[model samples]
Target: MTNDSPKPDDDAVRARVIEAADRLYYAYGVQAIGMDTLRTEAGVSLKRLYRLFPSKESILEQVLLHRHDMWNGLVERAIEGGEPRERLLAIYDMLARWFDEDDFRGCVFINCFGELGTTTPRVAEIVRTHKAGFQARLAELVAEAGGPQSLAPQLAILAEGAQTTAAIAGTNDAARQARQAAEVLIDAALGPATGTAQTRTSTTVTTARPAFRSRR
Candidate 1:
């Protein structure tokens, strides 16, 4: 009997590998999942896997990049239909919903950084890139809301803190709490409410250095 299995094309193989890697790497830390297991899960031959990804590190980098794209898409879709202010709040709302997902495992980038960042240069770089991209998105939303650029970084920190707290405490309240804090920050940064009678400062105000300690 002759073997008649059709060879998988590069696109199909790449998708399979990334799909498997995303699932496995996110669930079981990067260091724990080996290439052999990825091969089995992806249903790709060892030779094919190597041909697609020269090494495990390369696959890990690709997985992180894939995750960054996925995360950005999720946030953008959630906020796309909302007003400028709504767009900022939409981020927290999305996080709250995500926290309730059955397989919620903190953040893939955060988790991977905690687990393998010290040893994996590519992982560390990917983590930084992911975070920088998120901050950039938040900054865009802040500017859209007539908020000062200085406030964007602060809001981003609150968002990150909320995720870390929610994941560690296994509670759904962090997003709400963060959202509340974000509203206060956004309001202060933007100025008094239109309905409320109050004197407004005409001169530009500069923010002092952030008091929050570094999480790094």
Candidate 2:
């Protein structure tokens, strides 16, 4: 794509604003930045900022969308060059690299979920769609790789939790734990022989373990 930046125009100004906003959110936190600061950083007038993003919430939503696209591209590229089982590992491998990055701050969607509040349903919907797509992709990869059918969803949940936990922990050690847990889950769900996945179901009464309660 040709450069849309460095021009004294709307797209240029907006792109700069977005880049600054991205940096602010990644460096600080989403709620920490405001429109005025972003405008100043972009060297654009208030009118231009509004013309680009309408509102602070709108800008934040775009920031999330930007993040989603970038990450999705990474995932798609990884998925493109792997077999089903290898593709599953590709996700973890990607996370491993991300965890090693000094500025890594976990999943942006999760962070945005907390920053989002109840501003716009549309923004919320976008976030939900991204997450749902990721989980669905995980499920598909698991099925393709011959993992246990019944546990795909459960494993997805576990992976999300691990991502959140690793972000909070902000350490390579935490990421390693997530990776190992993923392997164990996969091992328990070793490749099925049949062409289709076999889902197991059983009725059992069980109490919730306090350790397993959601932190959110």
Candidate 3:
């Protein structure tokens, strides 16, 4: 059992700042957004917002972390309820909706890195760490699907590429096409193991629920 007590007020304020930053960064490129604009957009006072994230780059780190966690949570839940092949396909299905947003810019991690280019060590670290986790989980799922070690890295590249194309092409259909291509790649790599994958698919008005959370 767990008690869901409210966080201390300051912590809650900081979380709100991070959420606002995430929304802004997702809709607009990080370089295009400034702290004053963020203060106005978040409706938090300059003094208070600074207390939460001392710098815009700091806010960038939080934004990336929050979105990466949310993405993992959604995918983990989808994978749990789906079969192996379905689980593999679920990754793209999760990305597809993001492309439909009016302000759809691109995959945040890749986008941020492209802009930063290792100039900010902390921000760079956040992207690398988040992506490493993605690779690790993807590898595990690939192995579970009875794929070779090579297949995990290969599938990860495809997934990342799919997200890139969706953002670049500015259409939902691009992602679908990429997913189909990835499925073919996975099939060729795994042989008979392909059919043994997914057991179910998601059909709903609701977003896939988060399957995991931190102890905090």
What's the lDDT for all of these models?
A: 0.77, 0.67, 0.71
Candidate 2 lDDT over 1-216, as tens digits, reads: 334233446666667888889888877777787777778877887766776676677677667767777876777776664456556666767776777888888777777777764665655676777777677667777666656666567666766776787788876565566666776777677843343544433122121111211111
Top candidate when judged by TM-score against the true structure: 1
Task: List ranges where model 3 is wrong by over 4 Å.
Answer: 1-8, 192-216
Q: Write the per-residue lDDT of candidate 3 for residues 1-216, one digit (tens) a residue.
A: 223333357677777777778887777878888888888877778976766566777677667767877877776766665556667777777778767878878778888888895787666777777777787777777766666788777777877887888888878887687678778877787654444454323332223222322223
lDDT value, candidate 1, whole model: 0.77
**Clash totals, every prediction:** 0, 0, 7
Model 1 error, position 78 (Å): 1.5
Give the least accurate 10-residue stretch of model 3, judged by summed lDDT: 206-215
Error of 2 at 194 (Å): 15
lDDT ranking, best first: 1, 3, 2
Q: Output the lDDT of residue 171, model 1.
A: 81
**How well does each candidate superpose onto the true structure, as a TM-score?**
0.82, 0.76, 0.80
Candidate 1: clashing pairs of residues:
none
For each of the candidates, the C-alpha root-mean-square deviation to the true structure, in angstroms, is: 8.6, 10.2, 7.0
